[model samples]
Target: MGIHQMQSDLRAFARERDWEQFHSVKNLVMALSGEAGELSALLQWVEPGQIGAWIARPANREAASDEIADVLAYLLQVADGLDIDLEEAFTAKLAKNAAKYPVEKSRGVSTKYTELG
Candidate 1:
């Protein structure tokens, strides 16, 4: 489903479970951070080149996928609770990043935008 639909479904789920009261922006942000840590843990010890194989393992893949969903769900809830349009925010951020790191200066570089010529 699209992000908007997923957000609606999540809201409905929360309402049905009487969880809306507990889903404040602060709590959601904390939950999102924990989920992000879970996702990062899946790749913690693997060499960069072996990350694909690590994720390809069924159990690891399942855990990673669930963590990813958790992260997205919390993020959507946060945006919805704050009345933010995630797509618009993403688009705007992309535009800003594009300006900060133009193609010629950023291509083949691993430097941050501020460090790029």
Candidate 2:
């Protein structure tokens, strides 16, 4: 289903469970941060080159996937609460990023946009 539909379904799920009371945008954002941290922690200690192997383990992949889902759920809820269109927002932001980080200047480098020149 699409994001709006997913948000609607998620809202209904929360309403049915009476969990909506705790889903204020702030709370949802905090929960999202926690979930993201959990996902990050899953691969934080692995050497960059070994991250593939680390996540390739079935159990680890499952654990990371669960954390990712939690993160997305909370993020969707946050977008719903704020009435933000995630697809539109992402597209606009990506265009802005592309303008700021053009290939000729940004290729093969990690410098911040402000320092790209």
Candidate 3:
């Protein structure tokens, strides 16, 4: 499904459980960070190539997926609470990044934007 549809479904699920009362933007943001940390923990000490294999394992994959879902759920909840359109925000951020990392300066490089030009 599309992102908007996924967001709508998540919002409905939260409302069904009366979770909106505890899903303030601040709380959601903190929860999102915690979930991301869990996802990161799975990659700890894993080589880049091995990461794919680890994530491919059923149990590992499920854990990673759940962590990612948690992050997305909280992010969507925060966006909903703040009335922010994720698609619009993403597009705007992409535009900003494109300007900050023009291909001529950033191509084949992984340096920060400040180091580019």
Q: Estimate each model's TM-score.
A: 0.94, 0.94, 0.90
Candidate 2 Cα deviation (angstroms), residue 46: 1.5
Candidate 2 global TM-score: 0.94
Sequence-dependent TM-score of model 3 = 0.90
User: What stretches of model 2 exceed 4 Å from their correct place?
Assistant: none
By TM-score rank, best first, the candidates go: 1, 2, 3
lDDT of each: 0.93, 0.94, 0.87
Candidate 3 lDDT tens digits, 25-74 = 88889888898898888778889989878878899989888888888878
Off by over 4 Å in 1: none
- For each candidate, C-alpha RMSD in Å? 1.0, 1.0, 1.4
Indicate which candidate wins on lDDT. Answer: 2
TM-score of candidate 1 on Cα atoms, chains taken together: 0.94
lDDT of 2 by residue, 1-117 (tens): 898888999999999999989999999999999999999898888899998898889999999999998999999999999999999999999999999999999999999999998
Query: What is residue 96's positional error in candidate 1, in angstroms?
Result: 0.5
